[model samples]
Structure formats: C-alpha cells, structure tokens
Target: MSTPQGGSSGGKVRGWCPDAWRPMMAGDGLLVRVKPRLGRLTPAQAVGLGEAAVAHGSGSLDVTRRANLQIRGVTEAAWPDLLDRLLALGLVDADGGREGRRNILVSPDWKPGDDTHRIAAALHDRLGELPALPGKVGFVIDAGAEPALSAESGDFRIERGSEGVLLLRAEGRAVGVPLGHGAEVEALIDLAHWFAKSGGAAAGRMGRHAAPLPDWARGSVQPAQPKAAPAPGQRELGTAYGLPFGRLKAPTLIQLAQTPGITGIRTTPWRILLTEGGMPGQLDGLSLDPNEPLLRVDACPGMPECPQSSVETRMLARRLAPHVVGRLHVSGCAKGCAHSGVADVVLTGRRGAYDLSLGQRAGAPPLRAGLDIDSLIAHFGAV
Candidate 1:
C-alpha cells in the first residue's frame, strides 16, 4: 500500500525534535508522533497505525512516556507518504499548527459522560483560542471520580476534589484553587497569559519560574502525592501490557489486533498499555508479566539512534537491571527526555562514556564520570 526508500530506511541526524505537523529526524529515520484523542486508540485505529509504521517508516513504533505513538526510522522520501497514511487513519491533525497546540492529557480511565472527557473535549475544541504556551507545557484533566493523573499532570492540572468539585492546580504548588468544570479552559488560558506576563519565556516551565501564582488563584485544598500506576494484568479497564522500554514492534501490534478480545488501546505516561481485552497469550518484546524487571528501567534511543549520545544505552541498561536497585534510567545525554524525574540509578551517556549518579535525576551532575557498564555493575556490587 506504500513505498519504501532505497538503502537505509532512517538516518542519524538528531537535534530539536518537533512535536506535531513535521517529523523529528533521528538515527533510524524520521519520527512522526501522533497524540491520540484523549490519549486513546480504537482497535481499528491501532491496527492502521501499526500498518502505517511498517509500510512507510521503520517496522517499529515507539510509545512515548507521554502516551503518544511515534513511527520511527522513516526516510525523507517516505515522510509525505507517512503523513498521507496517518491522515487516512485519523492519526494526525490535518492542520499542523493546531496539532502542536492541542496538547491535553486526560485520565485513561475516563468515560464518555465523565468530567474528564467533557472537560478535555471542551478544551480540545478551543485550543486555538488559547495563547501560545510552550510546546511541552500541557494540561492534565483528571476529573474522574478519583484523581488519576497526579504524576502525569504537567504544568497545569484540572482535577476533582474529594468533595466532587473541580480544582485548578499549578505545578509545584501545595494546593489548588476551586473552580467549576466550566472554568477549566478559560482559567487555564488565563494562567498561560499570567505565566507569560510574569516572564515565563525567560524562565521556562512553571516549576522553575520564580514569580508566584496570581493573587486570585489561591490554595483551597492540599493535593495528594501521586501514586504509581496499577501493576500489569487485567483490571476494570482491560488486560495491561508492558514494553521493555516503551518500544513496540509495529508488526506485533498489527498482529495483536487480530487476536481475540482486544477492542481498543489506551496508554499511560508510563510505558504501560491497557487494551480493551486480554492480549493473545504471548507477544514478543511485550510483557504481560507485571513483575518483569525490565519494567523498572527507563531508556531512550542512544548512540546510533540519537546524535546526542556517544554510547548505546538500552542494551547496557538491560544488562545492568539485574544488578541495579530500584528504578534505573539510561539517558542518551543530559537532556534526560526518557525519565524526567530522579531515579535510584541513572547512567547518562556522554562522548561514548557514561556518567553514573546515585539518587539523582538524568540531568544532574554524576558522582563519577566516564564509567562503562562494567563499572556500573561493579558499583552495585561494591555498595
């Protein structure tokens, strides 16, 4: 149904990765990510997405920690074809400009008539009206009966209070201000204006900005700490599956749809995927087993896949997982796109070597520099 390129299917040119409209160039190929509506994919849509990836790009599709699907390793000649296929599959925004603006995350557990969907839908239609915020700056609509996006909420959050009222929260704030579900979009846009007015451009991200929230926005209730997602397996939603490092082979996903019981695909900010039904007994590189140790590690494309890295990351991480304690992050470089938060073990790649740090985030300075995977394993043994 589509054409492929001669020689290599992807390239190794890497720099600033684009979010919507255009694909980001990577070592393998061009990466085109699709942010699903409310972060969901119907079974039919999922099949189409997997096929599109196989037909036009690399046979691999990456499920980002942001709950989006990215077709990896596409050649320059194949990008346009990939765009056409994506549009036909209803996987992208026809208007590239709006595509970048429509960044809204909702609780995966939300239902049709629930506040999460209602609010998210309203905001989706009005995305063009809001002032331009940072591409990564996003909203988490967790208005489900129980708050579901405590950890996933980015700069701003619209969540439900214990009393069943809607509250708007800014990241790093201890409490949230009470608002009706009706005010979610307008209030958020106003905050964007507020953020820009307070020198948000100079100091990127809400948490880093020194200015305080506007006077009108005040703490009505203390928000709870975020809890980890439900472990792998069947739940009220469906059977859950985990990818070793959030990578899913497109052909495998295509086959997964052919299996019985599956009806839809839902993803989390984590590397977990929840389908409408149980997965077909076994899937290569996909984990139905909840306790898999590979699930504890986070990694990004390194070395050959990304120009930023000097070493291969995931392969080494996989080898080191058995020796490392708690969560591990194998970042390509200091940017730390894979795991933003701190982890027990972090190995950041730099000029073909790794900087090791304990109890630190990916971007932080390491305790020791220029260590290989063996040293990493030995560090665990020594401690």
Candidate 2:
C-alpha cells in the first residue's frame, strides 16, 4: 500500500496494487514480476499464469503500463515453483532478478525478421549482461506501427528513418548510430551505461532529457507518418479497455478471455487492455470508444488506497470526463505515477482542490478550482 521509491535505485519495492489485486515486485524478497515481450502470451502461457495466480498469494494478475504482465499473490515459498512454470512457458527473460530493467516496447506486429525486434532483443540481452545497473533502466524499440507503446516514449528509443536507417533518441536528443541488424542496439546500451555513469538523472524518460544534448549529437529525427491500419483480414481485431486503477478481477479476466475469436490479450502501461481477435460483435457491448471521455482520461489510485494520494483521482477523472479533449492525465499527487510521457492536459491534486495545466508546458500558473467535478469539466471544456 506504500509507494515504492521512484526509479529502480530504491528499496522495499512496492507492488503495483494492493494485496486484493495481487501485487508483486523484483527485489522485495517475496513477490516476483514476470514480464513478457510486448505482453504477448500464447494460450499455454495464459494457462500457466492462471494456475500460478491460484497457487500463489491470490488468484489475480495485473497488466502494467509498459505492455507487460505481472502475476501477483506470489509468496516466498512459491517463487521458485512459479518461476519454473514461467520459464517453461518462455515468458521469463534471460536475467534472474533483472526482469524489471528490461522495459522495451515494439510494434505489436513486430515479426521475427524485423530489425526492431532484433535491436530490442539485443538491448535486453545486453542489459542482462550488466547486473550492476539499476533495475528500472529500460529501453523502447518502436517499429513505427500501430498498437505500439512507442508513442509513450522510454529511456531510449529506436525509431525507423526514411532512408531505412534507424534514428536513436537518448534523453530526447536525436543520436544517429550506424544502422545494422544489431549494431545500434549495442550503441544504445553503451549510451545507457554512459548516461548512468555520467550522473545523468534519468528524467522519467530519454526524451525528457533530450533538450540538453550537444548539437553534433543531435541527429536528424524521422518524421512520424500515420500508416493506414491493416484490414481485418491482415490484422487481428484488438480492443483497448481500461481497468479502474489497473486492477481486474481474476474471474472477469478469465471470462473475458472465453469470448470467441479473442485469441490474445496484451496489457499497456496505461492500465488498459488490448484484446486481439475479439468476438465478431463484442465491441458493441463494451464501453470502449476511444473518443469517449472515459477512454480519454487516466488516474492514479488516490485517497484510501494510496496514503500519499490527497484525493480520489479516478472518481474525479470519471466525473470530469465528458469535457476532456485529447489525452488527459489525473494524478493523485505530483508523483505522476500513471504516466510515462506527458499528456495534453494534466490535473494534479493539491490539498482538497486541483491544479491544472494545458499543453506540454510545465510549471505554469495553476487554474485554481473548488475541485468540483462539473466545474472542472466546464473549465477543461472551455479550453
């Protein structure tokens, strides 16, 4: 129920949620987290998690913001057994306690031959080689495609360029590295180590620190183009849905999986669910319209659940949803736990009221309000 220290360098790592939702951690000496590639899991892997959930602390699992899966309710006694099961399913990466440091994002459609996957794999392997590095040091490999978590950014980003070269961005500044199957991947790890050693404060992500890069290190960045989504025949049907405060009931998850044509399910770091091969007519029943107010907003669990949260952020977000435009983030406190990249609008809780900001600019004048939901929505609607 306590907030773990920010970044990977701290102590007594807290689970993502409360015990009822089944929380796990890396160095906590009790619970363990299992992160899969892009949150993709085979049917057998899914079954293994279901069994592990039941046998461990609680029969529950949490889908994290980084498109990874965590099996909660794991106990000290069950760690080895659960790990063995996960390893058998090919879910566990090569590193032992280093799984938390391997945060990589790639196109959901990233296939075997793609350079993106190769680079991501190389980076992950290299991180595994550096056991001394902090557990939270991570990277993202964006293949410049849909259903990708790349837009969220990360400590390092490898974006594809126009001339078939890969553009590397570290701490936000564009750094061009030689393009090859896995050459840039090595360069990225070297950059990470250098950044860590140089006392470069990991500012939430690579892009956040990009502004300070030297001119020569600032390589040309590729223009991001919107690609037409693949047709239903070529692409699998995926539905994005959020779990209130990133917690989903075990039975609900299992039942949701039972729907026909729902072949796979992946979790985004934003506490949303992406189900692939959805039932022919399932989209109609669920409240998942992306343009809808509920889908456009996100909040951290505040108040009773998190002692540090001064207000109930999710309730406020839901109440103010109707007037929200674009993507909005509501944090219980200034920690901004729910977000990795900046949102179009941000509402941070202070005392009994709220402090709001517009656009990407930070530390502007606060739009003080009585914290009334309707008034908040009206203020945002006016913007």
Candidate 3:
C-alpha cells in the first residue's frame, strides 16, 4: 500500500516514460517500467518477475498500453537490487539507452519465423544503429497474416500491405513505401535518420511533425485489414485473461506462471495476457469475461500512487462502472495516461475535484466542474 505525500507529485508533465533504468517518480515512490523482448516471457521468467515485484517494490504491476510491464511502489534504495534481479532474469535490456530507444511494439500473436516475428527480431538487433527521437515516438511491427496492432499507438509502421507486400509507413501519412524482402530494417533506420535530421525532434512525435515524407518513401498500397482485438477466452495460441485497469498482484502472477503446461506468456496492449499452452481456468484478481464492465472503463492510478493527481480514481471508477452506459474514463489528471482517445464520458481530476465531460477526452471542455465524489457518483447514476 502507498502512503500519501500530499500536494502535487511534482514533475514535468509527460515528456519521458519510465523504463528500467530511468524510472519516473510517482506518489508511490518510483515506477519501474520493463519492456519484454519481443513482448514475450518464458514461464520461468514470469515467475521470476513476480518474485522480483514482491521482493523489490510494490507487490503489484501494471500492464501498459505499449505492451510493457511496470513494477510499482519501488523505493530508491531498492531499485539497484531490483535492476540486478531483472538482469539475472533476462527480462530487461542490459543497456538502458538502447532499451529506451527501442520503442518497438510487435504483434503479440506473431508466429515464429513469420514476418512479424522476423522483422521484430531484426529491429531489436539493430536498435543501436537508429538515431535518437522523442521518447513517445515508437514503431509497430504488424506484418503478420492480418494486422492486429493497427489500432495501437505508433509513429512508424511496418505492416503487410495489400497482396502481402511489406510496406513502411510514417504515422500521419495515409500510405507507405514498399520494401524488398529483408530490406525492412534498412528502410526503418533510414527513416529514423531522416526524422532526426529534418527537425522532427521539435514536434516530439512523427505524427505531429509537419514536414512531408521523402518522395522515395511514398507508395499506393493500403495495409491489410486489421483483425479483431483479442478477448478473454481460449485462442488458437493459448488462453487469454483480462486485467481490470491493467493491474494484478504478485501472487496472482506467480500462480499464473506456475500453472501446469504453461510454457510462455505474451502481453498485449489491450490489458490482456496470453498464457501459452495453458487451459482456461478461474484465477482470482483477473477477469475472463469479454463483456466485463470494468474492462470497458479506463482508470489511472490516482491520489496516493500518482504524483500529478489530486483525486483518488480507481475506487470511484469501480463504483461508477456499472452505472455508466458507455465507455468511461476516470483520468487522474488532464494528461489522461490511461486512455488518450475519446470516451463516452471522461471524468478528469482537477484541483482535487472532478470535472465531467461527455463524448470527449479528459482535456475537453467539461459538462460540469468541481463536483465532489458523492455528487459525481450521483450524476453518473442518474445518467
């Protein structure tokens, strides 16, 4: 459990994200984010991570939208030991800078030796060759049979174009440049160098940059159709389970890792975890229902956990989840880290009070402002 420090969490608003070496200070000590290589974990690695979480920081973890994991509530003193443990488990990149710059998201459903898998592996190996860009800027490898990560956030994309051709695309652009077989990484590195040299760093993200893509990087092929988002249930690859607000306790993780016949674990951006080779079964502190109301809602760790927040979030979100009719977002602050996209109803925390918005995101003009928790609950209950 986290003890409150009172006042603001006191940090710049949203410049860099937390990584294993450079962790962000939250209300709950520090938040250490870990990026799994290829978004995968052996069953032993999963158990090791669970134990590390219990031994080093808060006995809880957060599954990020980037398909990464965060160990919460770590004190400054414990971070060194925790990092050593992570290195031993082979869960984090040895070089922090390389890990930070390798902001690549691969399709979790990728098969071995498939386009997604091979490209992802190649990119990981060549990350050191790429120039530095903004921390939030990232790449996606969705060159699978069907694009599953198309809707996820990314500034650069490698996807299967129409008729199964491989294409590299900038995020804001509608089309991409076709690549010859095995030339994917070379094109990606060249694009990164271009972005770095062309004043794209000022914009902080490729999609936000105004400069036009190079002429050679243009193509007419549309990407393959995106597959449906994975849901909690059995899949051809494994059994999937959803985490409410992308959070789970250490013991639960240990239990999942120790399940018989489970050989690996795959993390997805949708708050779902795939237990490779495991059968469907009940697990406490996890949801198996696709239609679970809490799954539809997004809430950040507020109050005592996040330094930027003034109000407690998840508890109120839980109480209001069933009462709301559509997608609900209870953001700790205007940044809306939990969900950047629009929601049916967005409740943003401001000056320790709640501001309500309908059919908008957290920063949009609110329908009502400064409502206390009880009144906020009543307002949603009446809706």
Candidate 4:
C-alpha cells in the first residue's frame, strides 16, 4: 500500500461522491468508493476488496456513513487497474449510470428471501427505468419486522407500517403510503418520476425539497417502531463489531474475511459490521465494547489526508472523546463529511484552528473560534 504523498490540493468540497468509474481527487491521491450489493459481501469478495485496497490505493478503507466502502490514496495511473479488478470481482455495476442510480441501503438483518432482500433485488433490476436523480438521493429498505434504519440517511424509505404492511415514505415526511405486496418497485419508480417532474432536482435532496407530496404519497399509517442500533457483541445471526471512527485497515479486513465459520458480512451505516455465522474470535482491530466512548465520536481524515482540512482531527477527537459527553463531531471543515447531521458538540477546523459550536451541525456558527488543540483539551478537561 502506498503512503499518502500530500500535495498542494485545495481544500474544497466536491458535492458528489466517487464511483468505480469516476474517482475524486484529494490531498493524498484519489478516492474510489465501492457500493456493495445490498452492502453484502461474500468472504471471497471481501478478501478481494482488501487485496485491491492494498494493491491499488492506500492500505486503509473507510466504512462510510452510507454503509459503503472507500479505497483511498490511489494515483490516477492506478485507478483503471483497480476498476478492472473490482469489475472482475463482481463488486461494481457494469453501467456506471445505473450503478449511480442504485444507491439503495438495505437492512443488514435481512434473511435469504425476505422483503428487504427481494425488494432490494427488484430495485436493482429496475434501476434503468427510473429517472435521473440528484447524486445524493438514495433509498433505504428497512422492511424488517421493525425498522432498524430509521436514523440512517436516505431520501426515501420502504418500511413496515403499523399493521405489518409495507409502506413507501418520502424522506422528510413523518408518515407514508402503504404499497401492495407486489408493487413496491413500480411505486418507487413512479415516485422518482414524480420527484423529477415536480422540480426536486433543484433542491438536491428529498428532505430539502419544498413541494408537497401528492395525495397518493401521503398517509397517516405510521411506520413500525425502530429497533435499537446494534451494539458490538454476539448477535443471533452473527457477531457485531464496530470500526473505530468508521475505518478498517487492509490487514484487519483480510483477517476478518478469512476467519473461520464466517459465511458472509453485512455492513451498516453506524460503523458496524455483522459477520454472519461467525463467533467473536481474535478480532484484533475492532471494538467489542458497546460503551466505548470513541464510538460516539465522528472525525474525518483531517489535515494532509483530506485536502479540505485545515487541521489534524482524529487524534484530537480521541483525546477529547472520554472527556466530553454525548455525540461529538470533529469536522476537518465546514462540510462535515464525517457526520453531516446535528451533533451535541461540533468543532469545525478553519485556518489551522478550531471553532467550537454546541448542539448544532458543523457548518453552523461557532460560539468560539481560533482555539488550538491544547486549548480544546483544556476546555474539555474542565467538562
């Protein structure tokens, strides 16, 4: 794996993410994000991904908030070879356009032929029929007995209703319309067209769009209760492990992929992975304690690793993790790629200094500014 050779890359926010066909430039090199099929990976595919990460980019992988995997530090020269390897492993979409459109997040708890699995497969097959959407628009299929992905990010959600009926929900709405058993995908396609025709593209996100949903798309049928976020430990289906700060090294991934009794792996947006049918054995770099404070913190690859960052982040976050309470987001910049949602404590980096904010997202105005790492540690130490 190549180490990051920092360059004079400008600190700017690129509105979209990188796919297998198109990568994004950063301070270290280029970044290629892989959206797995329903975030499911066979052991062989997982091993291949780790190998590719080591061979073509940096030896590190990021488990993104969208439950995708990112290979960082790739040079322009290495991207084509990496893309070929990914395609051969059956981990990429043959058509980049369809791949970009198929940004569906599945419930990791799905069984072999369950609603989550079937609906996601059907959506994948029907991707070509949907209209072009904003790059960040996505769907979440949490059709488990209870919705487990409510807090995760997505523009549209397919979840169980109060009476076990499947409902299709617009993102910002509190309720959703129930769908017939066989019509989930078709209804979804209709909604996509509705969004496009209603001028949703300008808003860029379903939640942000101002237009009211049509009568057919609105209902009072509340979604079923949400399940608790999975903690790091043994679960009925497998063992759950947390990636500290949502990152895993190539060696650790390869080890987990090769572990005995592991049938497959499921990724979640909460920095957790479920190793199906596997026991908690020798997990060298993963967190097993649910109460680990660092798990509550979100920090990006700040400074030299990310061109947009003005200061180093993870280390400072670590130092403050235990000292602070509630959810903390140490953003490298105002973009807050690490955690876009509101956090209890937010520290935005600017001009090699930190700006402190409380109970807000990263871009919100800070209560104080220009503090150094030592000052932050001192401030948190008092808390």
Candidate 5:
C-alpha cells in the first residue's frame, strides 16, 4: 500500500470540510464534495463524477460517513468548470444555505415507495419547511418498520416502534417520541425549531447541545447503533465494496462501479459502496475480503492536506496496519472527525509528533507524548 501524501497546498479550507458551492482547500488541491441525493448515485452520475474528478481535480474520491462522496485534489482554476459540469449533471446545489442544510441520510437498502423511501423523500422535499438549522445538523429517515440506519450517523431520526408506532428519535437519547405516521414530518420540523430555540447556535450539531428533549417527547433510553454493513462479496441485494481508507481513485470507481446491466450504487456510513446488481470482483486498492486488517483502522488527511492537522496520518497508519488488532484511529489533530467516539487504540498527532492514547478518543490526553512515528509503531505494532 502506498502512503498518502498531502504535498504542498494553496487553498485555505480545513481538511475534510465539504460544501457544494464553497469547496475546501487541501495540500493537494481543492476538496469538493458531491452530495448524492439520499446517497443514491445513478450509473450515469457516477460516470460523470469520475470524469469530472479526472478533468478538474485529482482522481481520488472519498465516501464520507454521511454517505456522501468528496472529490479530492481539484485546483482553484478548475472549480468553476467543475461546478458547471456538476450543474449539467444535476448534482450542484446553488443555494449554500439549502445545500448546507441538506444533510438528510437514508438507508441505502430502502426501495422505492417503501416507508423508508417515502418518509425520506418527503423529508428531503420539506427541508425548506424546517427552521433555520445548524448546517451540520441533519435528520435520519430510518423508518422501515425496522431501523436499517440506527447505527448510521445522524442527529435526528424517524423510525417505527416495536408496536408499529412512528417515533422521532434524537441522537443522544435512547428512546424516541411517538408520532402518527402522517405527523412525523411536522413533528420533525417542530423538533428543529425546538433545537434552535434551545441555543443550538454556532455549534449546529444537536448532540453538542445540552438541552433535553421536551418532557413529553422523551421516550426510550436505548442508544441506536447503526446496523453493521453487509459483509464484502455477493449478497442477495448486491455486492458491497470496502477501501483501505475511506477513499479510492476516480478511475477505480468509474470502472468497477458501473457494471453491465446495473441500476445504481449505494454508499454506507462504513465508507463502503454497494452495487445493486453487481458482484465483488478484483479491485487493486479495495479490500474484497471482509476481514482485511486495514479495515480495522480509521484516519484523516493530515499535515499538508488539512490546515488543522498536526502530522502525516495515512502513511503511519499503513505502516501500523499489521501490528494492531481490534480498532485503531489515527487522527491528524485533536478533532476526531474520522471516528467520532472512542477506539480501542488512538494515535493523535500533535506538534509534528504523536500523542498516544491507549483507549480513548483522539482528543483525550495521550498516555505518552512526544513520540515519533517509528516509536509509536513499535509499541502498538504487536497489539
């Protein structure tokens, strides 16, 4: 595996920061995200995105935890042309506010006209109806009688209860408030207003706020863990794909993703892709084997790529791949965007060196400090 280098960059956007109109700058080039509506990309859209990545940027692509795709290494000069191409492909959202607020996530397995799809589609259309929300705050339309995206990322969710009751679930809370099937959207909109009114200001994500749900709205206390993704290889629905990291080359996606007689592709919070009718075949960078060691790691574009990053992350992770077991997170900085929660072992970069945390988030103070990459690897390589 080749190490990812940030190189020298010219732009000023933070690493992994994505918006439709305002692309973030990285060490390599501009990083622009392509937010597929409901995380579903048509075969044509996928091909066009692959072409756009090649033409306007580096051919590298990332599947985000939110199930959106980011195009990496786009130059400043190519942004306008890239936007034009995205517009032509019906992928660009001109309104920055609308684009920012359009963070709805759906179960990739949702079928047309099903409850998940129906509620999700309705929620998408009604985004404008909700109060002005934090750009990062989003709703998870996981209503399919049973929750398919419970473990998936989202702040608010719509789900059906055990008794076939519809409920509005909050991210931090275990239980959800019940609502009638027809009233879920209105209830969701009301919840948004409540969140904003409760001082969900600059820190727009709901989980960050301390305000509790309405007394009547409080339901269960059980955490909603998103369901595990399909094991790689052929499944009844289709084939699921995984990458060494969350990213892959455009050529790889364009070629391997669009197979003969396939309909569309689905992305997961695991950073894997699902081909509806396609099966797993040979792919150089991706892991067709579900148990691949690299799959147990998480990392971000550090140093040159992210202005906030403190060191190089991907290369160190690649080297540490064989020595570690369970789960490991290599965060460029204190911000643990790669893995929001704790991991079995975390390597956080600071001041060009790394702070090692035995079992905690990257932000937690390291058990040891001022260690170089070599030292860090030697210690944990055997875990």
Candidate 6:
C-alpha cells in the first residue's frame, strides 16, 4: 500500500502555505475537518473548535470557503472519539459520509431563530440517506442578509422573494420551484440528486449550466426583492490582511477571539476572513481594512507544494495584486482550484510562465501569452 507523504506507518500529512509556498506539516498523525452548520457557530462552538484543534490535532483550525472548519494532525485512533465529541456538540448530526456532500453556503448574517436552519437540517438529513449523490453537490440558503458570500455563487440557492414567495434556483438560474416557507428546500434537493444520478458532468457549481423550465412557467414569476441595504456607518469587512497566504498564526487567531464585541468571524470560500465587528481601536496597528486590494485577491498553491504546479502563482499574483480591480483569482493551472465562480481577472499558470484571462469563465482562452511576473503586472497595469 502507498503510504501518505510525511507520515510514518500512520497517515501523518503535510500541507503548503498560501499559494503553495513553504512546507507546513502536522505534528499529529491525522487531518480531520469540521463543517460548521450554516456558517454560524455559537461562542461555545468557537471555544470548542479552538480546544479541539489544540488537543486532538494541531493547535490550529482552518475556516474553509464552504463555511466549514478543518482540524489538522488527527490520529486514526482519535477519529471516533473526535467525531463523538463533535456530534455531542450538536455540530455533527448530518447523514453518514454525507458531511462533505452537504456543501451549503448560507448568508453570513443569518439570525439565530430563522427558519433557514430548519430547512437546512431537513436537506442535510435527506442528503445523508442518498449516498449516490456526488460529494461536491452543494445547497445554499440565503435570507438576503448582508455580507452575502454564497448567494449568487452557490449550486442550489433559496432566496427570499417578495413577501410570501421564496425563489429557488438550480445552477444560478431560476428553476420555477417557487414555494412558501420550507416547501422548496426539499424540492431543490430532489432536483440536485436527479442531476447527480443522471450522469450530468460535474460542473463543480450549479450556475455552470442552464436550467430549463416549461413553456407555461416562463415569465410568470416576478423578480426577487432588492436586497436590504447596509445601514449607515456600516461597511462590509474584506478578508485580505489576516495573514500572508491564507494561514493565520495561532496567537493571532487567539487574539482575534479575545477581542470584545466581535459579533463573529465569517469565512469565505475564497480563503478570506471577515470580522463582523468594525475594526477595533486596539486592532488599529494591524494593517486591515474592508477594501484593501489584497483582501479582494485569491491564489492557489503552486510549485513546491503541488507537484503539478509549473510556476509560483501566489507570489506572482501578490506582485500583480496592486494593479487589478474588483475581484481577481490566480490558479496554478487550468484546473482553477482557488475560485468557484467567474472572476474579474484570472491568471493561470502554464509551462514556466503565466496566462491571463478576463471575465468569469475558467475554461475560456487566455487573453495574453504566458508571461513572467513583472511583465504580467505591467500588461494588466497598462489595461
């Protein structure tokens, strides 16, 4: 049998830093990931996650773009016990082996008593029973709250429509599966399972394909209500400066936890972090803002970390970050692993160089030839 890299007889593993830089290995013998329900973990859950990291695996936890938490360095022996603990914490009651398949991204500001959680729980239970569904099948439920991350980008989405209707979408297109309250949630799941078992190519996201509706259903539904505007003096915090390359040091994370009045931490799929509270006066020293260019940039690991990477994409992207606008994503290869949706700018690594593409489609042809880091920056800057 093939042993995992960096592990003895056990399954010890190692991972790369941001954009696949320096090597970082887990001291423990296992890597265990925790998926947060609806991206809302209570203060108790936060403390539990921190403790789980320090005791079972590494003293660190990674918040993934899917609104989940990952605990590295787990040992095989500790797996059952850890799962038991997590389940007891009310965070692990979903379907068997269905945790990964329940990739739902809800609004960051989802309230505590909203019906969205009830609907998510039902969908998760249903998904658990259907093991045949692809592991990447995802569902997102948005309440039209602020700091919306997965609303537009989710594979299956449920957004508020008018006062009584709830809009349902499959692959970012309206599916005409309108219903009241929790009615459409299960319908959305059935639609996803149908697509998965029908041998439809894994689009990796729902919006990648078009959803066809019956002729009678066309143009009958009204447009969804406009999302509520953010209040005055309120700004959405961007996830740019928490750390270099997406990993924050343990001490810094602890310090962030200790800050008072911090409603919570919101993690995005782009490997960025957002603080619900405004930049605290005490945190003024840290170079952070809701609109920094670095916060809007994303890159995948390249070169040393991923054996398939041909060039150092993260460093190259960082060097070019200052010249881009809106949101930019840099991938190590054509696979485009870092981003799930259309990016304003995409820099994909090629044979010892880079290729740039504009617009959101990943497979689109490059706009320019593979160029070096400096030349790439200059070219984008000129545009």
Taking every candidate in turn, the Cα RMSD to the unseen true structure, in Å, is 3.7, 6.0, 3.2, 3.0, 4.6, 6.4
Better of 5 and 6 by TM-score: 5
Backbone clash count, each prediction separately: 5, 12, 1, 0, 10, 10
Estimate the lDDT of model 1. Answer: 0.78
Report the lDDT tens digits of candidate 2 across residue range 1-383: 22322213223334232221123442322334556666566545666666666776466555656666655545556656666676677777544445556567655556566766677667666666543444344676765443244346566667665555666666445344335555676667667766655555544344454345534335665534435422222234466665554655555566566667777766556556666766433332234444456656667655644445666787777766776767778877676767645677888777756778766322235556446555676765743
lDDT against the true structure, per candidate, is 0.78, 0.57, 0.87, 0.88, 0.77, 0.56
lDDT of 3 by residue, 162-208 (tens): 77889998988877878999999888989989999999999998888
Residue range 153-256, candidate 1, lDDT tens digits:
47778887765678888887868888864788888888878987888766667777779789777776755444468677778877778888889998878777
Model 5: lDDT to the true structure? 0.77
Pairwise lDDT winner, candidates 4 and 6: 4
Model 2 residue runs over 4 Å out of place are: 1-33, 54-62, 70-90, 93-95, 144-150, 201-218, 221-223, 226-246, 258-263, 269-272, 275-288, 340-345, 360-365, 369-383
lDDT of 6: 0.56
Q: Which model is ahead, 2 or 6, in terms of TM-score?
A: 2
Deviation of model 1 at 158, angstroms: 0.5
TM-score of each prediction: 0.91, 0.72, 0.95, 0.95, 0.91, 0.71
Candidate 1: misplaced stretches above 4 Å? 1-17, 224-227, 278-280, 381-383
Error of 1 at 273 (Å): 0.8
Q: What is the lDDT of residue 15 in candidate 1?
A: 35
Residue 208 shift from truth in candidate 4, angstroms = 1.2
Looking at model 5, residue 87 earns an lDDT score of 76
lDDT of 6 at 371: 78
